[model samples]
Target: MKRLYQTVPTGCDWAVEAQGLVKTFGDHRAVDGVHLKVRTGTIYAVLGPNGAGKTTTIRMLTTLLRPDDGSARIFGYDVVKESHIVRQLIGVTGQYASVDESLSAIENLVIFSRLLGMGRKEARQRAEELLEEFSLTEAANRPLKNFSGGMRRRLDLAASLIAQPPLIFLDEPTTGLDPRTRNQMWETIRKLVNHGSTVLLTTQYLQEADELADRIAVIDRGKVVAEGTADELKASVGNSSLQLKIQHSYDMERARQIVEQVLKVRSNTSTETGRITAPMTEADRVTDLLIALREAGIHLAELSVQKPTLDEVFLTITGHGVKKDTAVDSSSAVEEVRV
Candidate 1:
């Protein structure tokens, strides 16, 4: 099976490199000629809707499945020919939390550390260190069944880091968590990168990618439709809008009128958000709008220049919004891999 994708090797400084990667299942081309070059010690995010070939791409790069075409390298080692070496350099946290339901947090980390060839005493020490790092020291002795969602996630992350691999693959690590827990996980990921780990993250949440990714690649129908930093991608949309919120409801109509008269373009008002949004045709439109509004005595609660959202970007790329129902879970994705 390994021989299928194994080919001539290449050299690279990237923490991860894949070129023209392809995968198929019977008639389905789950992954289609995807290419990715992730810089070392930074976070790269892959975001797409359900069944968008995200999981299949991850499986190929992780050496869990042979690609139908193309090649991938991990830290300059070919994923296929040097799979053992590749695996040695990386750790994976799947979409779902993988900690043992019955094991205590400390026990889980200890076992993982021991498996990474630590001695009993060394394992114990490492376990304690990780427990503190993840802020789970208080629950270290409690069975994981009693742990909250956030604690379990942190523990799962700690276990995956037992070997301190240089590169980590996280597939939707924040799925199914509340906003607070999700934020905590985001911080943990940032801390990992700060301490010198390169992360390749796949997620359905646009905001997650916006907040955490140093670079984002959007995949659809197994193709990379776009790739750039959040700001770069937004700027690529090629238009900015003057966004204004008036302090009083009575000022909405006046504010709208002032914006339309200044920009010479129709403005929209959202009753829900009380915002007047209009596209800016000139470079100084927002500034012009501000001065005009102030002259007219329209006090604003908020004013800013706005670009298209990641959500809007995705819609433009894929011709639809993300369908959470179409999202393939990790376990199901793994099971669908063809040899």
Candidate 2:
């Protein structure tokens, strides 16, 4: 694989840029010619399935892994040639908590501050500020080993801020968190961007990207399949779907046949729920479906036309559900490597 990094256009202001990035491990090409542009002070999310090279792209951008071909830049600093400078301007939070279990919440942050070259008094003050900001002030003195998963995650994020980097890379920041805690983390990320910090997030949760990202890129098999705003991507797949809920389970197959034969379009049927979903390409399809169902003596309990979702767009592009693959669970740790 060969990766190339190009500078942003003369007038363009991008916090991150990649062009023709390629990475290979043995015969496996992990990242293939991925071109990305992330503006300053915005959240850019990379979304894909488990083995889709989302993590590999992040590693290349953060300067953790050298691409076999292509180039990447962080704030105009070359990820390969000027990696030290790039590292200085970025912070990263991996999937799992990276805090030292033996260290207290405050101690962990202080350690990072010290490593960043803050004086002892300055480091202590920075630690206190971050602990309070992350709502871990009350647990500052307690060891991280005693904290809940959410608390530990918060502490890990807070530690990443010790250096006050302008760019942050968050890899599955909310994975394994409860709904409430996940929302809280989302709020934190929003707050960071509000203060002019840029964030690049990679997540499996479509809802997370929909809520937090200013732009999204969907990658698969080491290549980018689609890139746009949520609504834009949804629109790419074309037309809404009319889902019909038949009165009886036995009527589902019959309804599907009618929809396919009459509408001249493929109909998707759910065996468990007795629902038939067909793409609504024409305005009269809904009316036609209802009339055909009635003529066939099939009672439809419910009917709805729904626009495509981000999940649907992902599925259409990848030929698979956006759900994570369980076989890659053990390799997720390897995916966390970042600058």
Candidate 3:
């Protein structure tokens, strides 16, 4: 009974690379000329709204789907040409849990271990270890049908790691979990990277990307629109905003005039509340605006500076919010209306 351990060298450099990767379905291009470079042993988050081609990109990289054009390499093996070798070095957790509902938590993991070529004893041992690590030890023998959503997600993640592949692709891994469970999952992901596993995650949650990603790539219209650290993207979209709430609605115009005079730019005035907001690109600009407001005798009931959010960055780049449909195939990316 030989133990099967992945012998591929860990932590060399970029664990996943996509060069001009393109995937099209019918007349629609799901992934168009996308390029990504993810460093080894790091978490790189791909963020966008639904149907942003994130899943398509992940499929091509994992060799689950073939690209119409270009190439994607995982651990230096071509995704299309060397798919078998690539598959051996990577693990994938798609949008839904792929575990067998009839099997107990431990049974599910053991099955994955066996599939990975581990002997029976080794498979059972690995399953038990993972069950404990993911805090599923108490429910080790419970069938997946009896498990909660969070529990099932943890088991799904554990099974992917049964082979301890160097690269892991997580597509919306925390989609349906509660806040506490989502935090727990974040901790688990952090632990994996600390242990030298490189993770490529696709998620619509901006905060998740901000918290976990070493770098984030924003895909819109089957293209990479922005790629940078959270702060970099925020800065690229420009500065924090100084929002002023006037005591009286009539004072809104006054506040706007003062802000515009001080900031030398047109202030964004809210029509509903009469609040005026000016973009503050520099820390000094905040002070300058405050001083100017005081000198102008413009009194603000409330004033606060807010750092640019990822949503703002997305809006700035695409001329619409990430929630909007700006993709090449607009109909495919549109949010489904719930009855």
Candidate 4:
């Protein structure tokens, strides 16, 4: 309930801007030619699989790691040259909890507030407020080592926001949380943005990106492959998806041809279900498609037009699914950068 943020500066339209950012770990180029621009007061997501340089990009942006090449700025201040100012302007919550394992949740938050120069009484009040805000009040006295992963993660974020920096960086904040806890985290993230903090969060979950990001940048193999709003990215793949099942398996090939001819798009078929699938730029065209199928005597058992999902968009652009294993662990690569 207490005021957490200083007045957000009006000097820059972008909260974060980077061009051609690159970082290499010996032989591996963790981040290569990565570019991004995060508008002030919005949730921008860096969507990618593990080892896709999402964390590396975040580290460079947060001033925790230097780029091997390229340039970055936080709120118009050069990340390399004005890192101290940048540090004062942003908060970072890494993949793992960054608090001491032996300290109680309230104690850890109080320490964070005290370190930020809050008065003793103010620090205690602030810690108690954060404990309730993060739903950790019940465990406020429990040592962090006794807390659950979700609880620790919540506290980590609470600690990061002690000063309510203008910009916040969250690297896979919900990686291992249960569905309910993940939803809670999502709400908390939304609240941060609602209260005027620019949030840049890295996420592997397609639903998380779709649910939270005002804009999304899809990264793969250390490069940004796609960038746009959720709808824009989905539109990149297709408008809507058409799935049709022929009443007879013998009509499968005929139906596929009819679909392509009517929809003016290539279509694929599954031999097992005799189903025809194609991308539809115009859902209205389905009326003509159905007429064509009827004229051909291809009775359909089922049909539906579904919006393209982030999963489809990701796969279409990256040429693979979102679960690739990588050798780089950026969370462990650097000491936790709390600010």
Candidate number achieving the greatest TM-score relative to the actual structure: 3
Error of 1 at 315 (Å): 2.7
Please provide, for model 2 over 1-339, each residue's C-alpha lDDT reduced to its tens digit, 9 standing for 90 to 100.
Answer: 111122223453788988879999889999988878888879989888788898888888888899899888888889999998788888888777888999898888888888778888888998999988889899999987789989988988998777777889998888889999999999999999998788999988767888999988877789877677665554444357677888988777788889877766555677888777665657676777778889999998888887755445555545442223321321232232111
lDDT tens per residue, model 1, 1-339? 011122113344589888889999999999998888888889999988888898899989988899999999898989999999887788888766777888888888888777777888888999999999888889889998888776777888887787788888998888788998898899989998998889999988767888999988888889877776765554433256667888888889988888778777656688678887765658676777789888988888987877655445565445343223222232122222211
| TM values, all candidates | 0.71, 0.80, 0.82, 0.79
Q: Candidate 2, TM-score vs. the true structure?
A: 0.80
Best by lDDT: 4
lDDT of predicted model 2: 0.77
Candidate 3 overall Cα lDDT vs. reference?
0.79
Q: What lDDT would each prediction earn against the true structure?
A: 0.77, 0.77, 0.79, 0.83
Per-candidate RMSD vs. true structure? 9.2, 8.3, 7.1, 7.8
Task: Give per-residue lDDT, candidate 2, residue 68.
Answer: 91
Tens digit of per-residue lDDT, candidate 3, span 170-267: 99999989999999999989999999889999998767998999988888878877776766555544567667888778767777777767666555
Clashing pairs in 1: none
In candidate 2, which residue ranges exceed 4 Å CA deviation? 1-12, 237-288, 296-311, 319-339
**Any residue pairs clashing in model 4, and if so which?**
none
Clashing pairs in 3: none
Error of 3 at 141 (Å): 1.9
Clashes of 1: 0
lDDT of 4 at 226: 75
